[model samples]
Target: MTTSSYLTVKALTKYIKRKFDADPHLREVYVKGELSNVKIHSSGHIYFTLKDDAARITAAMFRTQASKLKFKPEEGMQVYIRGEVNVYESSGIYQLYVQTMEPDGVGGLFVAFNQLKERLQKEGFFNPNFKQPIPKFPNTVGVLTATTGAAIRDICTTINRRYPLAEIVIYPTVVQGENAAPNIVKNIQLANNQQLCDVLIVGRGGGSIEDLWAFNEEIVAQAIFESRIPIISAVGHETDTTIADFVADLRAPTPTAAAELAVPNQHELIQRIISNKSRLQQMTSALVQFERSRLKKLQNAYPLATPERLYRPFIEKIVQLDMQLGRASQMYLMKKYNALQKLDSTIKSHSPKNEIQYNYKQINHMTDLLTRSVLSLLQKKKDQYGANVRTLEALNPLSIMTRGYSVTYKEQQVVKSVTQLSKDEEIDIHFHDGKVQAKIIEIHEGGEK
Candidate 1:
């Protein structure tokens, strides 16, 4: 009942702190619970509550201990903790000082992986458009991995065996633990700066997620994304994927696969070359045969093969006209001769020497005039036929093309107007002698009136 028996908050707090420190069970404790009211301070300390259905305990992980954690803590996250129970003297409250903590019955790293994956997915880190094309024939292949491991061995062996021509550049890297992320990023930058390799294979042999964590680091992912050289990520087994895998230009299932992807197989390439050579030869032969067939068809065409057939009608017409002219001339001469005979019979009854002489002179003059007129008519018909032939020659299509004119066609159709064409369209210009290919650069829709 005495005031002396009653303890002040400070005194009670000190007693509790000392008592907790002294007890061996409180000094080293184990706890399993769900996290709540989690707060990460600017000073790098984490404050949270460890709660279950029964009770709750206030807990804290200091900067030094928090730095060693593999994953971030969050609200409602189930975790297992190794810590010491103690009372905070200043606050006069009991709290747990966490030394180490991990997710309960689940991997915290996996949780972290999912969170980062979601975030980066939203930021388009895994966009296929951002990926660069891997070189089919790489002169040099850069390998980023631990110098002494199965990963390096497998990669080097595969590359050397498949494509002996490619030079391998090895970048020794730490693939695990605290310093692995930064080291991976540095080597990636170094490889880019050196510009020695056409492509890069970055990875290690299959292992636990913890062992492959360096590839999952954001810095490593960013480095791979920024690399000027195309990178093939081969971090772990086929089933394992990382942030680096998403960001890299390509991903291979394993180290050996990465090497296989980095350089082409010499045997396969040789076979391809041989196949292509055969194909080219076959194509050339086929093309030659096609052109020959086309030329043969042209040679058999009516106009080119039998040019005389085209002029047969004209020749027949000319012959008929000449025959008509001869018949008309003969008819005129016969009629005049008959009239002369009748006149002679009549003149003989009243015949005189002077009269006969005058009639003979008149007959000579008429015969001479008839011959001149028939010759003039034949010459005029010949001139008319010659003029018609000249007109046909002027209208010949081949004759017109012989001038400086050319015909333009787009996609095998005659290009008559600007509306039928568009920018960047390819056209063929045919001249009398040959054909030329051209591309349309600009288009103006209207034409001259």
Candidate 2:
């Protein structure tokens, strides 16, 4: 048997890769399928599987191409991919190298719009708190639209007619085509930097969605959102709305409406002035009549009609005060006179002669009573002294000695009982006339002698 040489896996993979690369048909292919396992790597490259009911294929998009995509690819989303087919030698797998990808059947512009809207919304660009209010009556209106377009003309005409005082500063901008978004952004920045206008009107005449797409761009939306000058977005017709509208301070249905909003109507103002003048005249006449009636009433009032009426209470108060003063003076004088009389009577009662006579009478009466009380007290004391003398004589121990009684003491203490004396103790016998020293010979008990 003849041995045939076979190719290695690496060699076979490279060979297939080269074949796919060289083929004009496979070099650039457009395929439609549902995305699966979509992943965006840290390097910004995207890898996903594109599969249909029949077959599935792996696809990769490099960072550069993937960056151009306006929307993120989600798994199971239907997509149309334009790429080259190739094989990776390391993995030995065939894959699609994606150059461009978009949602199936949907316009790329709409996708971009939705994506930017969603992203900016998440970042709070469409936050109502950031929205500025358009000036009701702008002194200078800055219009960012094509100079030759109907939008400018309408705005200028409306402003000139409605508010002739307002100065219109036109920042001629391209509002359509490729340069439209950048031009809009530039003019907005310029207008803001220049500080030329109180209010900014950014718009174009009514147009198709394509012509109006510039206002929907992220750059335009960001510029409008960041501008300190209040912006009114009037893109396309009333039915059309753009990202600029959502981000701007205000959105006008049309350019003319934007102009009208920026200024007040001159005719309306004039009519208001006239109506105010009439109201003022009516009010002034009414006020004058009211004041005149008030003056008449004041003149006819009691105080104004009779000048003395104002002073009547003061006059009556003075009369009453005078009468009270007279009465008070009389009462005070009477009280002082009565007090003087009482004092004079008191002085008279305290005269020296009368005081001496009164004291002498008191002394005489007291002396008489003292004389009788002294005699009675002396008699009672005499009787008490006699009674005490008799009591003493009756209680006297010397008297009892004269009656043949005596007291015996041992060691200077009176002995009351025979047992009190010791047999050999010295004692004294006290009698009425003498005290005799003696010795206790015996102590007698009972009747023994």
Pairs in steric clash, model 2: none
TM-score of 2: 0.67
Error of 1 at 15 (Å): 2.2
State each model's CA lDDT, in order. 0.91, 0.90
What's the residue-level lDDT of 191 in candidate 1? 95
Best-fitting candidate, scored by lDDT: 1
Question: In model 1, how large is the Cα lDDT of residue 227?
Answer: 88
CA shift of 107, model 2, Å: 2.1
List, residue by residue over 88-167, the lDDT tens digit for candidate 2: 88898989999999798897767778888889999999898998877767789999999897889999999999999999
Instruction: Write candidate 1's Cα lDDT for 285-401 as tens digits.
Output: 999999999999999998888999889999999999999999999999999999999999998878698887999999999999999999999999999999999999998766788
Query: In candidate 1, what residue range of length 10 has the lowest lDDT sum?
Result: 440-449
